[model samples]
Target: MRRFCSVMLAGVIAGLGVGIGVKAHAQAAPLEVRVVVVTTFELGQDRGDMPGEFQHWVERYPLEQSFPAPGTEHGVLRYNAQDHVLGLVSGEGPSHMAAAITALALDPRFDLRHAYFILAGIAGVNPYKASLGSAAWARYVVNGGAAHLIDSREIPADWPDGFTPLQGHVPDEYPRPPLHSIAGDMAYQLRPSLVQWAYERTKAITLPDNAALQAHRHAYQDFPEALKPPHVMIGDTISSETYWLGARMNRWAERWVSYWTDHQGEMVTTAEEDIALCQALALQAKAGRVDAQRILILRTASNFDMPPTAITPATMLANAAHEENLPGLHAATDAAYRVASPIVRHLATDWARYKEHVP
Candidate 1:
């Protein structure tokens, strides 16, 4: 009986050791991500052939490991284990982006506490501010769709395209209700110092230019900025689910961005997902899952927000629908990767310094 009792005790102790080992392994399973590259969509497979927002990062980094992201749009996340870099596709629009980013942030498999997020994507450029294929580092991302709207035909003649701030009496109304009282999350302001640093680091990048892109720019001869070659610049983004085009809507976008940022932001790139992505990141930051200040938004112009001189909005839409790809699609994608890769590499390689202090 004494021998049997001793054996039983030994067996219990061994089981306890196994339990502790399993717990330790689980705790160590989570990846310590240093940098996250967030793209809005992927064309087909992650590699080979035509590149989408996610392809260049995938092929260039050679992300060899893949993990299932059940709820995300692409349903998978790519990882470069050696560099501790993650590539994610948040889907195409605001809803998809929010869901995917939120899911990723909440996942226990990734330790994002100190991770830097780079949202690189393509957008419609404001012809007056930027040319096709130009890249812009955003200082502010404003939600252009969060407002009261009236049909243009029914709106007061004095009103501009029938868009007004929530609970405001007029278009671009000021001294408005406090943010929390109304739709408080109308705009997200990134760290200006970081944005400036990124801009300075990449402003000299020469974007891809070809005869086709040049011809597109020539059509916008009236707009001096649109006629220039593709280049990197510091600008702001306006995000709306609706793909709006026309001079009147462009004016509305300009006003909306200016109003939300108190005239500190100029509308350069118009996109659909950045504001939603920012909102998710902000919430995750509040939850202590990620660092909001480390997020960088880079948008390259794939097309113009408004039709070029003499081209009607309907005609431009028709042309776009028939084309296999936008005029600046390739150029914009190349520029986005070229401009953002340096920052991503620096942060991932020198993580010891950036993990403690955001550069």
Candidate 2:
């Protein structure tokens, strides 16, 4: 029965255009690192690029040791023994994410059994729900790139959006694949209580808010809540490499989450790396190399998923760099660090408390 399901699922995944799986051999012992920081391009870039003191424990704890992935250039993993934190700079894409994680999982040097993995990065915010530079704790992560696309001109007139959730379908009518049936079959639901715990621990903290960001926020006045400065919230994420925008795409994002979670999901942030990272971790968990439930995703907004109505789509696309920088990349990164540091400190200082409890 299991083999039949796997073969049938493979055919479906091919049709959907999203491939899955990670190939890694089991090692003798898991890495002892208690906390692992998994970050995309920005966090994984050169250490000198870090704007301020707010950083992974790497800065204060300093790099105690480094493990160089054998077959790759600049794919070294750093560990801070003092704080029990490990860092991986997975380059910015699905491919790089899988490679980095596969290397670490198969390295045979680290016993990652009890390590708590934190997937943190900057994501485009749904301005209607969150402001620039706010941090969000995710309960559900969906792949925006998972959908089958039909050009707007090609799609049937009745279909409201150009995106079809899967092949041979129109908007709102895509078949719902059962769990483990295909790539992005179900929204990878993180541990709800852990998500709540992370948010409750950091929600009260202040985040980056500035006059320039406020002025930008003003443009989103129609989205009352987006007008506020950066803050912390618990929400869901949409992961896709394509930078989609506007009301049409916005509705698609919400629907995408709802489809995968069966009506319990909400799209709060848009990201490019979560699905890839989570998929890799899922593979590791299946091998007993890591605890899937220990993984947490925290995304801070560097820009909005859609520009305010005042801006034209063409202009929004042209000014992509400006939008990515307006709230200041530093501001978003800082917000993530602020909201996540205490959790880091708590875990490191009291590892025993979370060791067996898996909180």
Candidate 3:
């Protein structure tokens, strides 16, 4: 079934077959923005007027259209008619992401009715599932943030970790909030057809490789996938505000994703900003401003969720560059562009076919 858009037009004169009249109108034609790539942050952090951020996006889509509203951040809608993709930056973190998305959804500048939104960013990979520099297509986004943490040192002895679900209590108990309760359920399931479609397009593309990346990956020889170079895979993301570390926290994150998604999704990338992105998009969908199902999240791993067995958590954290692997960062970003470009191009070039029927 084709999902046809139903919008009331006010500016144009219709039915002019020898029996129509003209009407006074005062609005320019609504711009049709096909694809909106929402990236969290640009460059080495900080809010600056930088023209370049996404390497592949900047190189491929050089045509930049200024933002249409006031008070919103100064970002352009990058266009690549040749490739059929548009890009935007959502700033960073929970608050910034919420504001940036609200601006775009409510801006009254472009027609986002049929636009496909892609959330592309780097994240910490769960070594149990994948290796550094690998990219993943998420079917579920679980909010590892906004939790009721009691502190591992202070929590009940039997409880798995300090972090607990909203209104949830006790040791190893799943959240059992009231019926239709919106407090505890944080997992957002995106359109599966769209996820599969995007995954199929660029999964074969090789992610960037480097000696540093390989050396770090080698530490996890026990895990088969982590031993290989970065590759594309299907997984879920755990979005948390707390910069958590250690295997205990990793275990909690893994369980949190599964618990929220009903064991349907395996947690892969541990990153920030995804839940914020999901909430904003969900509201926009409810308002009939954008198609919620059209949104997809693609996260790449720049580092592992936790260090290997040989390295102590304290020792690993003490390392000068514990948070990010430079090589993995480059590889992940490179892989993000490679995996997303083809799907974006396909949607842009074949809009007529995918308009109502999701690929």
Best by TM-score: 1
Clashes (N, CA, C under 3 Å) per candidate: 0, 7, 0
Instruction: Residues 209-284, candidate 1: write the lDDT tens digits.
Output: 9999999899987899999999999999999999888898999999899988989999999999999988998888
lDDT of each: 0.88, 0.75, 0.74
User: Stretches of candidate 2 above 4 Å error?
Assistant: 1-31, 43-45, 50-57, 60-64, 70-74, 178-186, 322-326
C-alpha RMSD in Å of predicted model 3 compared with the true structure: 6.8
lDDT (10s digit) by residue, model 2, range 72-136: 43467777777778876777766777778777877778878888888777788887788888899
Can you rank all candidates by lDDT, best first? 1, 2, 3
Error of 3 at 108 (Å): 1.3
Give the Å shift of residue 184 in candidate 3.
Answer: 7.2
- Score residue 19 of candidate 2 by CA lDDT: 52
Judged by lDDT, which candidate is best? 1
Deviation (Å) of 208 in candidate 3: 1.8
TM-score rank order: 1, 3, 2
Model 1 gets an lDDT of 0.88
